[model samples]
Target chain A: MNDEKTYALKSKRIKWFENPLISEDKVYWKPKRAIWFWLAVLSFAAAFGVNVFIAPLQETQILPYRIFLASAVFLLLSLHAAALRNPFLRAKLYHYCQFIFALGIFLSVWDLLTDKTSVLPVPYFPSAASVLQVMVLDHALILKSALYSLRLFFAGFLTGIVLGVSSGILIGWARQWDYWLSPIIKVSGIIPPVVWIPLALSILPGSFSTGVFLIFAASWFPVASMTANGISSTPKKYFEAAQTFGAQKKYLLFKVAVPHAMPNIFMGILTAAAFSFTTLIVSEMIGAKAGLGFYINWAKAWGAYSKMYAAIVIIALEFSVILLIIGIFRRRVLRWQKGIVK
Target chain B: MTEVLIDIKNVNRIYRDDAGHKIYALRNVNLQILRGEIISFIGPSGCGKTTLLRLLAGLDKPQSGSLSIEGKIIDKPHFERGFIFQQPALFPWNTVEENISAPLKARKIYAENKHKAARYISMMGLAGFEKSYPHELSGGMAQRAAIARALLSEPKVLLLDEPLGALDAFKRSELQNNLIEIWQKTKTTMALVTHDVDEAVYLSSRIAVMTSRPGKISKIINVELGQNRDRNDDGFIALRKEILKELRLASISPQPEYNI
Candidate 1:
């Protein structure tokens, strides 16, 4: 049937019949490189063209926007050139083209509407350039604030994870510990970490430390509860199996129970992270001297909406970066759960 | 072979149903496990072969009487009795080598016995799979690693609770051969709880057949087929048939207490 004569003789040809190209061995032709690079460059070029030709309704920093668009176009071109070396990256760029094109069109519309005409209000709906200006011009201050926030986050998160895991292990294993501590964990976990601001301010000595405590409180409960839940739900057979191995309580907790609860503990951490980040921002806005939260508040008071938007963008960037790192770590730690994990 | 390693005398385990009726998981069970001999407990489901195995493993307590090893009362589980569960039950986070070496590390004797893990790894035919996780392995290979892990600890008595119940027939028979070879090499006394009559006859030296509902041993058949028994042989088939007939009788016996 593979030969053309046999294929012709057959009343109903197979799906691949009448095709000139035949693969002796099963293999596929290489997929063509995606055209995202050209689209991205063209899109950015269009946005840049709109920025240059259009006149603003009021005097605003248009230079930064122009430079940003130009650089974006240049970067896209360079990336396209670089992608020639990496086949995987070429595929990813193809996937990104539509989004990039859409974003470029959106930016052009925004620039024309905000800068060219006061369609959405002059001060309230700042153009993309003004927001980018804050990120580019005030980068040093923004970076400093980010550093302070990250320091607080790490301090709180590490403490919370350490204390949470330990307490969870204790509660899950010991009936007495579960009896005493579970109620407190349940009660305190329900209350928002922001509610502790007043109490933390009064006792914690400084706003920065209070911020840390607030973040810690935010993270600790979910982690602890999840760990406890994970350990508690571990199959009784695991304990019995380990017991037959003369496994001590420590070994049982770590080797048997802890490993079993790991997925749950990870779930808890993800929940805790969402809560912790929100807690950090709120606490910083309330009391901290140098942080993105404080910067956001300061920008709001001065009616610098663009800078406020810039701070939020920075916050989002930080969050995305942290999430990316965590995702990588989780993938590695839970690599054993390759096929089945939801 | 004559020396007794574990003795179970008049052991009883009872559970209360929701309606407050007493369900006898095991009742007045008596058996002696001999040193360096592979003894199997074969019965129908709910016949407490596993319950009896667990008693020997010290994973459960008998309501009455005692379980002892070398004249020492077994009130709690110890490494002296390595228990292989129905499932391989290997730690998912660990690699094959890591799971095998877990026992040595748990005892804080890793420095001295770390080499034993590598030896058992190859002995169990798990040479290239040292770095592979349990989830990555097939059913037979994972069980092989589980067996290797248990054997690494060098227990006086190994308790197996239907360790081959999950595999396909081909894999099951393959592991059966592996088990016989391992037993011969280690000379570690083993107590297997199984429902498969062929498995019981092929692997064990003595078969303790039991009945359900107030589970107790109904008959004990000595399988002296010697080492390297051929499954197609007349003697092997005879013993298998005899055990099957005994099981048929055991299952059909009505509960005397249930009778009005």
Candidate 2:
């Protein structure tokens, strides 16, 4: 009846080429409550049942109703929100419902083998229940270690990024700086930071500083190289265009070179973050008194395999959260890259 | 009597190819651009039309001779000479307003010329797209923004290297009119390099036809179609035919040795 409605109908008609049979809207309708959410709830309920009803063949640590209560609360909340399309986590829950179901299935199978039956060997492969219990029981030490690791990682990673980017930009822009500095960087970059443990520990005054040193080394090389590459690889056209408008060296560097090299710099930071984490764990394992890596080593020495597994899980979660933050920050900064990147 | 805006004399630009062979990008090129005139260098590819444009913009240096504007030697690029490339070359990060106003900021004269950016944006019909990024614009729109950017600087001469080559026919005609309007308003010297004979005829006061392989100007034709050129007019069609013939002549090389 209206112009917009006619245009919409015409556009929809154009979609006939994509699928001749199902170009109509009614064919693509989805239900109010997703089937996957209920399936996840059912799967989690089954795991809860296995944990409660069946007794273990051999004695293993099982926190009375922690898992049961948590699952019950989670299921109740999920069930309550299933029908509604409220803004908070509705889409996320629906999307990851299948993954949640698979996790429950995995936990159920793991429990049956290790705790409920004596088929698998003990200590080496602890039941999921024991691992979860260790996380709760050793919460104090775990929390302290996680805090220490965070401080060290942040100190090392931030320092490395700042220095790496500054020097990289210098080297990329000025030929003299590249000639003078890149050789040393290239040499240091070739050697892995893990190998510098003995040397760095000897040179640095303390273990914490040495840990910082190694992590800084791990992050520096990739950031520098990627930043330099990004800066240097900026098309000559950009420079020429800017120069015609009376842009001097400083303006050109800040405006044209820096903006163009941003995607590459972000690439470098991502790589550096990953590498720094690797070095963080290694440095902690070797000498540090408190960290996730240290916790892992400490648990292994005491034959507390469950604590070691718990520490590893915490490390993954911590690292993932840090990466998620970086990802969000980068997406906001590079919002202009939407159509260009694609 | 119009004064000479740019005096280009016997300029040569030589570039070395991969095997260390000397290649002539341009050779012995001479042209004098007059003030407030639209002049075009029209030829086939590799005729060094772009190379000549770059030389005028001071983006590239000549191996011999020199280029100067108003008796001042053009050694480096300056705001006095604005250049437009085939690609818009708008910064991907900056919005339309930012792109157009970037020159003012770059020159550290933003306070004085800040108002001109808004005027130019409206002039180019990019008023609503001030916040939109260059990637968000169509090819023609981006190029228009680029034109506005160059014009905001108020250059003495505007060198265009196939600025409308990438646009579709409709967009090209639309932009051609936009260019004509801008030219009429500013009266800036426009030196365009294009292969499109119709575009050359429709826009420029004079067309310099060039030959390839060590490029040189073969002929310069005065349009004489007067103002508001109708492409279908008898005189306009005849002039277009005359220029096309010159271009054909420029493309063919005379080799007496091959004559039977």
Question: Number of clashes in every candidate structure?
Answer: 0, 0
What is the TM-score of candidate 1? 0.91
Q: How many clashing pairs in candidate 1?
A: 0
Interface root-mean-square deviation for each candidate? Answer: 1.2, 0.7
Candidate maximizing DockQ: 2
Top lDDT hit: 1
In order, candidate lDDTs are 0.86, 0.85
lDDT string, candidate 2, A1-342, tens digits: 356444544564543212322222243322224576677777777777788889887565677434654666486566557624332234445556677778778877888898888568888888888888888888999999999999999999988999889989999999999999899899999899999899888888887998888989988888888888888999998899999988999989999998888888889999999999999999999988889999999999999998999999899999999999989989988889988775
Cα lDDT of model 1 by residue, A131-205, tens digit: 988788888999999998889998998889889988998898899999999999999999999998988999999
Q: How does each model score on TM-score?
A: 0.91, 0.89
Candidate 2 local accuracy as lDDT?
0.85
